[model samples]
Target: MVELVFITPFVTGLLAFVLPSALSRQLLVLTGAVHLVLSLLLWKNTPQAWFAEYFAVTPEGLLSLLVISLLFFLISIYTTGYLAAHGLKSENIFTGFMLLFLSTMTMVTLSDHIMVLWIAIEATTLASAPLIYTHRSGASLEATWKYVLICSVGIAMALVGSLFLTFSMELGGVTSAMSFSALTPVAAQLDPAWLKAGFIFIVVGYGTKMGLAPMHTWLPDAHSEAPSPASALLSGVLLNCAYLGIFKTNKIMVSAGLSDFSGTILIVFGLLSIVAAATYILKQTEYKRMLAYSSIENMGIIALGTGIGGLGVYGAVICMIHHSLIKSSLFLSSGNILMGYKDRLIANTGQMAKQMPKTFVAFFAGFAGISGFPPFGIFIGELFIIMAAFKTGHYLAAGIFIFSLCVIFAGFARQVMAICFDTPAETGTGPAADGKDVSFKEPPGMIWPQYVLLLTSLILCFFIPDALYQTIVDAVHAIGGGLQ
Candidate 1:
């Protein structure tokens, strides 16, 4: 299983580069099927799975691999239909990079060494740059440039942190061994000063990539400009990759007796990210940009849950899964809308339901799911977060949480009303697209993928498995004391 996964993506990536468009897409879809099947087989054969020095599955790693691989498969299916509709069967760069992204993510999820994780994570930033500029539009080029520059610099700090972590081990008279499971046992013996420094740098580095507040400036621009498929991968899968790095490190921190330090940092950034989203979403003119802010808000909530610990971490895991599903659905549906027509002001696009009812309903429903509607996965996750806040005696944080959530809902709802419901013009106003005639309906290619993704998210809400939640609980338990 390990060799198949590890070798398949790289080899297929090269094949994708040379194959005809039809063949390239076929290769991707084939790989996706194999991954989906392997994921299922792994689920049935669940045990302490390992591949020498290269890959291993802790409980957390297993879950990460499963979710990411499954999500990648779904996204690839959507990409196929999406590109074909646009008459772009598959460019060499496009198919090659898709495989590269998959390979990078697989490397990240399967990595046992902390340094290997860092390397794989950085590679994502590099591989995704071309995907961002795939359109070759000026806006896309600018966005891609910013993404590369910012993420590259952020990842450099992660490298520095990696070095510090290595130095801490060396100072403890430990050899260069750096497997997570292996290093974790001896974290307590590491030097306090060096370990603390390493943790801070690591957070700063990964936090940038994770779109944590203050350092998250590039996210909206990139998401708004990139192709919708790439945007979906960025929000739905890439952020999770960064989050996993933080999770692994925090696990070590807890063992080294650094709970408060790590927790406080997470809480501060999480709250700031939420606040940033609220402020941005209130008047975000661009529909795609609005979704970008929504991603930031979701990332904030995830971090908030992680920072609070105990039940909060478990809640975070739920939120992570829920957010991935809903955000991708939302972005894909938004792409449906955007491709049909382009506009900055939501008010300009009118009566979406009349034109593309299926797309409209899917977009609205996705928004509702992301906004924490009842029976949706996010609602369950948020409910857990609220419960955790109360249990931890954090009345202020709880109050703020509810208030911020309400504000976010109101802001997004306002936009939904404009784009999804209102008439095209305000009274006797001009056309939605710079006074040019435009269509209300989205293409079939666009609508199908979104519907599939939306239904998948809704399904997650219904089948909330105890085993899944238990894995999260175990992962959170590992975060206890943040490597104390």
Candidate 2:
């Protein structure tokens, strides 16, 4: 049953390749639903994997799985409406790859063995690279190639780090299984020097894919060029999959009593990412690229929170959850803007409240939510993180965190306001390249998914179920993190 969660999608995706385009779109949605059901069942039962050595259920893994399952289902719904509007010739191929992408990400969540986890993460790159190229435009092609090249290089470094981890085991004369679950209990016995080396390489490698600073160059282009649904998944769940690797390794570091060393590196990298994002976001002209930078900034926040531990770790997890929800909704909303305006520039698009009223509600609300306004989960998450930072005596880091956030918020608001309220030039009323007027009819299918995601985040801010809360607690507990 655990394996079935990913296998079902993989098999269905293969079948989608040969099926009719319309049927393939249906298959994409059906696969998402089935995957979600299987994920829920696994959550309820917490079953052991058939291949216990390579895969197992963990608290963090399950959390990521649930988010991926939910987002994929909703994104698939949005994709249906998007496909209908664009009428791509390779719609079948697009749907097929989307399922494959889901399958690989599910595999990432379930993987336990270090090598198997590496394989799964690498497979995600393969599955998703094609999705970035779905449009086949020159810019899309460049973005796809850049994504594949950079991520593949990063994965290769991660493979070397995996080998280093095993070597660490050998140096300590440890004979444990090369799986995170198995190694964690005996992590203290591993050689400190080799362990630290492995952790550094692993962080750099996986961090690259997770959209951490410097290595995040591939992200803005990829996110901006991919189809909106694909962008949602990339920003929403895929980064989490990469973070899972770093999180697991950090667990081993905590178990080995090397938390300070590991945490410091994470903190430095996290701050660097946030600062880099702030510099670019203020100057960004393309709205999608701006959102891409926002994703980078949020990833940094998650990294920083994890490094802080205690309340900070808890806050990081909350940010992770809400970031996925809000960012995915924002990306979907960006798609609606793109469809109506036939442009990606913020300067050319305006008066969304008048032109696309339904999307305006979602877009503006998402803007507020992502900016960390109250009633939104992100606000709660960031607040907890800042409090934790101060409690831990990291005043300088906290100050930097707050300052970067404010800068980012100002930049984000300027762009969002231009899009949502500012009136466009009279030429904006002209026909688009598709021969449709600037007022493209808004589809409920596209509009509702964003709303559902935002609503879920809003509800979660106020009330979290016992099961979900416990799962989050368990994940943080492994890293010496707890609200208490």
Candidate 3:
């Protein structure tokens, strides 16, 4: 019955492919609502999967499930408005694939078996591929191929890594079930050499999907080319699904007393990602692409925090939740800007305060939140991470983290100001030049989802619900990570 959380979406997705366009659109929202209710129910009283060998719930997975559920629901409402305005071709295809994307990501969060987790992650790449190509532009086509090809290669490596885990078990003469829960207690008895090798491959593999550096090339292109709603899901929750894979594997490594090895690698990768984003962000042109790089930077921060452990893991989990909320809202707001300006470049889309006041509020607030400004959960999360890094004696790494954040914020703020307030020259070419023109009418549906997401993040910053706070603590407790 717990599987219904994903199954309902999967079934409706298939039906969406054949249903009439109008009905399919309605089905998308309906599915999202139903999925959210089911996810809440499952979370309320953790239920065992019928196929316990392949699926089960944990604190981490439940946390991811709740985020994915809420995001998809709000995004569904926004998509209904987006589709009507854009009148995209193959609406049915878009609806169906979006639902499928949700289902696959849900499965990834719930998967207990290592191979099953890999399968679900790979399925997410496949399900989201069509969504990226929905625009059907040459650029979109190219981006789709890059996403599929790169992610496919990365996931294949993950498969090999999963096999290495099993091989470690075989070499040690331990015949436990292949589930994470089953292997973790006996992980210390497995071959450490093979376990280390497996962890390396798994990190590089899923790290690609999670948008970590060196493997994050496909991410910007995919996010930039995908429709806004799809972009929301991609940056918002899809990356978290991939991170869950690494997190679970890291948990096993800690149980095996390989924490030092695993932690160091994560820290290195985390800093690399953050530094990489800073380099590109300073000279970025496209707004959506800028947001994409920001995601890479945030993922880096999460990795760094997790690697630091103790308070750091708690901070990383907080960053993960806040990032999902804020980034998704930013992407949705970008859609409004895209609709009004008919351009992706910040230079051409100036004077948003006058052209799209409502969107400006959401977009600018999201900008502040994402940049670690106060009154937002990310500010608290970042603060915790910085303090944790210092407490762990990662002084150099902490310096790099703080410096990169400053650099990224400076570059990001400059572009945002141009987008929000700069007046265009009287060239009669860009929309901003024509002071009287307002291309987008600012739909209530599109406007409100973003506000809701940002408001939720703001509320959580001041007061996290007791259950959610406990869940966050529970998630990190296994790996020598907790508030206490």
Q: Can you give the TM-score per candidate against the true fold?
A: 0.93, 0.98, 0.98
Q: How many residue pairs clash in each candidate?
A: 13, 0, 0
Q: What is the per-residue lDDT of model 1 for residues 248-313, given as tens digits with 9 covering 90 to 100?
A: 888888887887788888888888999899888998877889999999998999988888887788
Q: What is residue 305's positional error in candidate 3, in angstroms?
A: 0.6
Candidate of highest TM-score: 3
lDDT of 3 by residue, 73-145 (tens): 9999999999999999889999999999999999999999999999999999999999999989999999999
lDDT of 1: 0.80
After superposing candidate 1, which stretches have Cα over 4 Å from the reference?
46-51, 88-90, 426-445, 465-467, 481-484
lDDT of 2 by residue, 35-102 (tens): 99999999999998899999999999999999999999999999999999988888989999999999
| Candidate 1, run of 10 with poorest lDDT | 426-435
Note the Cα lDDT for every prediction shown.
Answer: 0.80, 0.93, 0.93
Residue 336's lDDT within candidate 1 is 69
Error of 1 at 349 (Å): 1.8
User: How many clashing pairs does model 1 include?
Assistant: 13
- Sort by lDDT, best first: what order? 3, 2, 1
Q: Alpha-carbon error at 390 in model 1, in Å?
A: 2.5
